[model samples]
Target: MAFVHSYQDDDDAPAAAATSLRRMELLLDPSLPQHLAGLALSQRGVLTTGQLLAAGLNRTRIHDIGRRDGWRTPLQGTRMVAVQTGPDASQDLMRAWNQAAALVLPHAALGFDSAAVEWGLVGVPRCDGVTVIVPPGKELRARPGLRVLVRPLTTHDVVSPWGLRTTSMVRTLADLLPTLDRPSGLAVLDGALRRRVRRSDLATARERARGSNGWRQVDDLWELANPDAETPLESRVRSRMIDGHLAPNALQQRLRDSSGRVYARPDMTIDRHRRRRPERGPLYIEADGRGPHGSPGAAYRDRDKASDLLADGADIERFTWDDTFDPMRIPWRLRRAL
Candidate 1:
């Protein structure tokens, strides 16, 4: 309920509100601009100048509304109203942020990793800021905090998830495949498959990507993806092994002692058949080579398990995040252990 600052007074209120949705919502009258308010609800309570006109707010009245209501233009020609909320703003990804960006640009849709995040996809690369893909010929300008891409988007290639215009899940994955390494791409596929998206979901996407630049890589990931992967770490480990041409014998393979006593289920396993060199022997690998070992008790338990595995004559290799990123380390270590 605080008109923190006046928009007409030339204060920096607009810029401040642009980055904070809670503050922006506080300035809008939900009852007056019914359509704009409804649209803004999906756009982080932020509206564009064009949307204002669509809502029946004339140019003069729009200016009057801006001055009277403290509407700020964070980006040129964009308008926002601040609402009230706590000082603790989360840095975690917000769907409303992308909605606002898309709503600002005509025919703009969130694409690639942007769409993937909106669909709650897991195991892809960590992305920040916003990415907006506009249909070719749309008059949109690049803005800070937004990456604008122009492409020819087809009917099947686009979707509206989270009430925001974005590329379809299939198209989104295809868009992201080339940008990521094989392992990172598998993580995305594995995550999607875990959510029950099968190879069938990608049929149209595969057809569309025929002969495209990264089609081969995407195709490989589609076939190589295993829903058994429970985490991004696991997918990354599998990817490195594949890169080294060391396909696992089985994912999440169960381990047992001579008497069939199940010990631990490592993320991946190499059976006698999958072993490239018989001398290197059977292998079991854990994605978390480095233990979080939050407590001394936890550390002791892990050490105990390691001791047991050693006694069983199992060749185990542990890979950490650092090892996964280094092209030489994890693959080379895995090869040596195998």
Candidate 2:
């Protein structure tokens, strides 16, 4: 049998054949130099000028290939690949958008909320542009399709992994530790530890982070995000309480009343401080980072538990995110309360 042939041109009687060929090429090779893959494999099909250049295609060849109807550069000197798809499509566009920015900036890495999404800390809706963290002195000119963010980072803060410079796994989690609630922060810490970023690495990063304005919080997070933590929320709370000097008692210390009713153990407990005035008594401490007491139901349970402690002639003091930030104020507040 002989093959059938059809001919069509820009304005031919049946000009759709040319368009059909282009569509077939897209179907076969989604990795086209200037083609934006599609809604299905959004992250897998992005190509950049550098990628094309690596494949032996020069700018002139790239231009010639796109001489006719081709991909548009949404930003001047920046190309965008628009594949044929529904306007309303839910795409896993984060990785692709980030890849584009990485390709353009080459020096910046995704950080903060951007890296949190990559490292599984938070869920983000589909975004159009890339969020990048660049070295302090590097400035990228404004471009139409790209939203450039120049997050200043010292050399110690940059980590090169998988051939890309990103915030180190520990540093990425540390960056979000202060902003994230307890459970979320615990989740991020768990993820990082599971990926084999060690506590020692976190310790080192924290040590280096000193003198940096926001880094004390990072150190606090290190203690809070313990890899061996079975009860992460409680652990975080305990660490914060100890940092605030509110937990004079050892972590996981056991306790019992005069009647021998054992308290399994409080995260932290301080024996009552007997003041000259009967009103000043020893107090118990609880750490209230985001996770251990994050949910409304959990908060209710905690309130009930605190009420029980009060009934037992124990005053209870709790610490939170603010306490972690300014730890010195905690002891003062506790003294006044006593």
Candidate 3:
């Protein structure tokens, strides 16, 4: 039998026209994978496989796509995330959330570091698996990429700020505290406070966390988190310096020229005593967090500030997240400088 190319008669259109029309239908259908072309992949990019399945493909199709080099598998099972191909890009963020959700099973909410990405508090690492908190009764064994947490959370503790049904901000922060380093933990907390996740919500989480490890630390974390800290690292670093007695008071601080107003705000500062003289000049310490100032531009500006301080005859000491982790390094450095 002759192949039927089109519904219309041959007089109506050419064979090429019918083929073109068929191709057009495939492009617009909601079922097909919506691969965004030319989109860049960074540490901040991610996608979920469930989204692919929902895009009119089954497990077999997904496996085929993987086999054909159409996808990259970063993690196994629950940790699996699908990165889209080409520049425009196609990622199923919702599907990623759901996959993380499946691993947590009942009584879980997308939260902490994971929520920080969801709420845009910070960049989500493309390689890391999603973070979720499951209530005490529903904890999963530690999988390769999955960080399954068994904790306490009430119904009210699982609300999201952006109208999504993830864990509430307070609960998120409380859950994250012990799991993350001080800087990363504080980043999520700082963001939550800025969004004004009500005190009552945090209080409720605290009540639920009464007997948990690291639960007591949340109050201290809350008290030290300042509004000025836009990023979690900022607040946590500041908090650690304070706890370590390394933080400098603004009034006693001097970073710029004694005559000029624009000065560097170093992460921490200390006064050095003189051996022969009555007193030595104060030391200005800068905490070069993840990016110095977080990017190249920020680093350049900070360098200028440092130059200004140096011009003013101030001694400067620089440290990073690692220095903070080591208690003796900071003090020893200052002592040697002094």
Candidate 4:
């Protein structure tokens, strides 16, 4: 009764094929304890108790499945039958939880960080629970790992791109920006811009949110949003730089050798004129995310780039995901280098 890990977009084909085989087996087998083939296939092995009952499983049978080794009741009445073991398991489980939330409260739409996750916005921190927003006066009790908020949402604010009722990208950003910390907020904005959420659209969203709580902060985040930021870590590094009055003069700035051939494109750059001590040299800041910069080959290339920049009379600084957390860490180093 070992459950198979659910398939995610980035999961290897073998894992997806395995999950598909399991799903096909569940669908084709009539002797299965719960005749929930259709529901299981559609919901990714997540089913509500109500769905279980409607699918002809009695309370006793449901209880038996709940006690089984591979099955779990993640929410009050939602049953999740999957092995939460692999790297993508948590994300798969999260999707299931979101599905369960939608199933349980068909009237409410996913909002806030949950909607951001649904929209695939980058820099969205992982949340164990789902956040659903209901209109004012709606009475919904909060369950374990489920948050219910009362807010006024118009038809324009909601969308179901994937058949899961959730906020639109603009609405999600508008609702989520103010709630996040400064660095996280800027990161989300930069990510949204990278995803092609136009600056004008964000401006309109900001204007609509005028006079609301945290509007100023949202506006500031909108101003800081740059499509040139290629990653959440880069956006976060820029945020810290701005916080410490060390904002870079350019992002993804290109460096050229004497022959005018592009050598390296640093994540952030400050020209010598912008430097506190112009004689020190131009500064290049690298926001090194793990995936691209962690490999040995990447490390070698990075060293080569650093050497070339150093030889060119440029001061180089590299920051990682961890370095951005300390507000003073990046700024202090850059200041000393400057």
Q: What is the C-alpha lDDT of each candidate?
A: 0.67, 0.52, 0.50, 0.76
Q: How displaced is residue 300 in candidate 2, in Å?
A: 5.3
- lDDT for model 2, on a 0 to 1 scale? 0.52
Number of the candidate with higher TM-score, 3 or 4: 4
lDDT of 4 by residue, 1-338 (tens): 44233333322231122232222122123445445654665775677888777767789977876675346666788877544455445555666777778777889999888787666676877889889999988868988898998888899988876668888777787778777778888888888877677888898777766676777765677887898999999999999999899999999988887899998999999789877776667899999998899899999999999998888778998899999889899889988888
lDDT of candidate 3 at residue 44, scale 0 to 100: 17
Better of 3 and 4 by lDDT: 4
For every model shown, the clashing-pair count is 10, 5, 13, 0
For residues 34-138, what per-residue lDDT tens digits would candidate 1 score against the true structure? 455545544554677887777777889888868887776645566655543433122123344465676656478888766776666766676555778888778
- Please tell me which predicted candidate would have the highest TM-score against the true structure: 4
The number of the candidate with the highest lDDT is 4
**lDDT of candidate 1 at residue 61, scale 0 to 100:** 84
How far does residue 143 in candidate 3 sit from its true spot (Å)? 5.0
Ordered list by lDDT, greatest first: 4, 1, 2, 3
Question: On a 0 to 1 TM-score scale, where does candidate 1 land against the true structure?
Answer: 0.70
Give the TM-score of each candidate: 0.70, 0.44, 0.62, 0.86
How would the candidate models be sorted by TM-score, starting from the highest? 4, 1, 3, 2
